[model samples]
Target: MKRKYSPYTLPPWLRKVRGACAQFIIPICVFQGIRTILFPFTLDVLLLTLLILLAVALHLNVI
Candidate 1:
């Protein structure tokens, strides 16, 4: 018989970091998106947040 691993499991430390990034950064990105939609001023913040989101997503294999 062969053992199998569940793909949902992650290392404890990594899980914490990934959870935090998702919880914190995702909301911020959403708000930034709204800000850009409402008032088209200073897109730098929106761009930065999107970049961060992309980086975090790549790191977590969410994309």
Candidate 2:
């Protein structure tokens, strides 16, 4: 069976890094989204989709 995930088991420094990433993810996603809207390039769209998925995963604490 797969083990349950626990942030508490992570190293202190890693936890801090995760916290920092969680804080910045939203604004980054927003900028990527606006950029995608303006450019609509294949790469930009793919990046935006990845960013959105990452943001959702972070918000849901699934990462």
Identify the candidate with maximal lDDT. Answer: 2
Q: Would you estimate the TM-scores of all the predictions?
A: 0.45, 0.92
Tell me the tens digit of each residue's lDDT in model 2 across 1-63: 999888889999998988898899899989998998888999999998998898888778888
Q: How much lDDT does each candidate structure score?
A: 0.67, 0.89
Residues 1-63, candidate 1, lDDT per residue (tens digit)? Answer: 975544257788876776666667766667777777777676756585676767677556664
TM-score of 2: 0.92
Error of 1 at 41 (Å): 2.9
Kindly give the stretch of ten consecutive residues in candidate 2 with the minimal lDDT sum. Answer: 54-63
Q: Give the poorly placed runs of model 2, Cα more than 4 Å off.
A: none
lDDT of 2: 0.89
Please state the error at residue 37 of candidate 2 in Å. Answer: 0.8
Q: Choose the strongest candidate by TM-score.
A: 2
Error of 2 at 51 (Å): 0.7
